[model samples]
Target: MRVRLDYGKVGLEVEFPDHNTKAVLGLKPTVPLENPTKAIAHALRQPIATPALADIARGRRDACIVLCDITRPVPNRLLLPPILETLHRSGIPKERVTLLIATGTHRPNWGDELEALVGGDIAGSYRVVNHDSKSLSAHRFMGTSPNGVPIWIDKVYTDADLRITVGLIEPHFMAGFSGGRKLIMPGVAAFYTIQRWHCPRFLEHPLATNGSVRGNPVHEEALAIAKCVRPDFIVDVILDEANRTTGVFAGDLEQAWLTGVEFAGKHVRAAITEPVDIVVTTCAGYPLDLTFYQTVKGMVGALPAVKQGGTIIIASECAEGVGSPDFAQALWETSDLEAFVRYISQPDVFVPEEWQVEELAKVVRHAEVICVAGGISAEKLTNCFVTPAESVEEGLRMALAKHGESASIYVIPRGPYVIPTLC
Candidate 1:
């Protein structure tokens, strides 16, 4: 068996003897700076109840829902407990609290993955449920966004005393950075709302689009959307390469995310003063899920990291084909991004999230995305997005050898979902 390990700025490859070429990625877990729970609680000391929690308690905000990105890496174990405790101490009862998994259109986390997050013991105590776009029973139509886009929020938001969310703050290519308002935009916003907000090239500004890596417009818009919901307090975490709780931000999302950006700048941030011609990244393995709807984030996320015509080697082990049954059909059927957006965006299109299906398909237009894994078929790769290679080395070498030192490749070894630029 052959194994490949990507150490940021370094490469480690090892070969093992095995009849089957089974390879599990290598990860060296880092001892959390302090237990995540402890760090979360400590980080909250400065913010939380200061004006932030007070406003939430005043009913100025109607609800309190703790949100975490469903697919990305979040210090849930460390993040969630503190919020519940803080809310509890702040006089917010458990019943008044709702835990929303901001899944966007991604499949709800089930079985072990879900269990592992909240801890087996803590999981049972709360009414922890997932976001279900297809479940009319779980959705409530909020009037519309400032953009005049219709929004369907969870009934919990409309009924609760205050709204709160928990998530990680990281550089996201499309949104600039994650956390803050993002906890709500794609976090809790209805499928239609998300489609509209995502449709606009919201991050066209220099800080958002230019080589400037910070102060992004995409992050601003996502925050604006979150502010629209008026969350009383937000507990945002900053994780390290090992996904451990490196730091925490609790208070106004904008303020907290400003801090998050500062933290992210220190860790995963790379000083790419110049635009790179090629980027090779893994999907981080989750968001792509069984299909491309989740996988497209990688393409969009990688948008900022590469040069205009650079190729992005997207190594995704898509175990399942295009995820949702409806999405898969649309992907295989669409020829290109333009046709995809046109067909799905049509007013007559009945599918609720048709544009999203189209957006995932649109990835084919931006850059050459190469996938490597046993998940989806190779045919799906070449026919739909870019092309697929047999292994990571093959893909990396393909891009590297092509560009040479001039190529300036950013290899996010643990990707398929992680926006290579952000990590």
Candidate 2:
């Protein structure tokens, strides 16, 4: 059987034995909204749990709208126009309205990339800016959370008369579901605040994995930080496999987000009768698979569907190579997974990008990982504690050699976009 995996700008097609294949897991297809613009307008007007956006923007002078960075495939062009128009209709002028890119700890997006993020018109006309998490001076101290995580948000967002976040609601590997409060906490949070939140106290928690929100420390900490900022409103959307807006969620932060999460949980989850001996996955292509650091999500997402000693073969474009300098350095220094785990597990030791490595460790501990990343060299992947494969076919051949030809194989084409759960 031939399956086209979400890979790079185009995608990769690999053939697997039909007899050995257990199931091909992916998101349950949903019909796109007939009129996305109308749906978005309706969602903003009759928003869940809170007053309409126009009412919230009424009398407000300055407004700041937060958006996820380029890594997330959010329909910014479609989602922003209606929002800006509503804000303008409610008395907020274009000059007073700022579009803040919630970069989290990632690097800033500029020039053509900036234009691609928000439409060219908005990028040129509006005061669009990137969030710099490393700059302490740029952030306003919002106080500390119950878990002792400091809350420091972008000054531009906090100083605004109206605070809003525009995001895509998807199944996040750590926070259960993405969007809503996430765009506030780690999205525009300060360096120290994000560091504390990504520490083992949250990442190592049992509930921090994908498709889990109740009692999730990561989710709780993010919610706590977002509460401190008191965002006025939010517009989050759910996209289908083609990245078209399927559902629009807008209104009260907690209420609307929970509603979206409930909706996503039902559609994004794929059930398996039992774990398989080998799993093949991807990092969902393009911007998401641009770096090896982001590729870890594909590995972690496939863990639940693979047996303890099974092999996971992940194909990622990683067009931008490894990741941030800090993350690359961490990968180079990590020769032994156990020792690396021990080091990061220490209370005093906290690395800037170790949380991703920590998540990668969870997968390596349970199953062997073989990476098919064209952008990264084999040596670099080996340094990162993963076996590098020239292609998915080569990786499959290697895995089959180890697991036997009769071993059951499960393929997840969209990677983290589909959560594999045991029935």
TM-score of 2: 0.99
Question: lDDT tens string, model 1, 135-197?
Answer: 545657756656565666666654566777777776554665677777777776667666666
lDDT against true structure, model 1: 0.59
**Residue 411 of model 2, lDDT score:** 97
Segments of candidate 2 deviating more than 4 angstroms: none
lDDT of 2 at 158: 92
Q: Model 1 residue 33 lDDT?
A: 70
Q: What TM-score would you give candidate 1 relative to the actual structure?
A: 0.77
Q: Return the lDDT, model 1, position 95.
A: 67
Segments in model 1 whose C-alpha atoms lie over 4 Å from true places = 1-32, 52-63, 90-96, 135-142, 200-221, 273-278, 286-291, 301-310, 342-366, 396-410, 414-423
C-alpha-based local distance difference test score of model 2: 0.92
Each prediction's Cα lDDT score? 0.59, 0.92
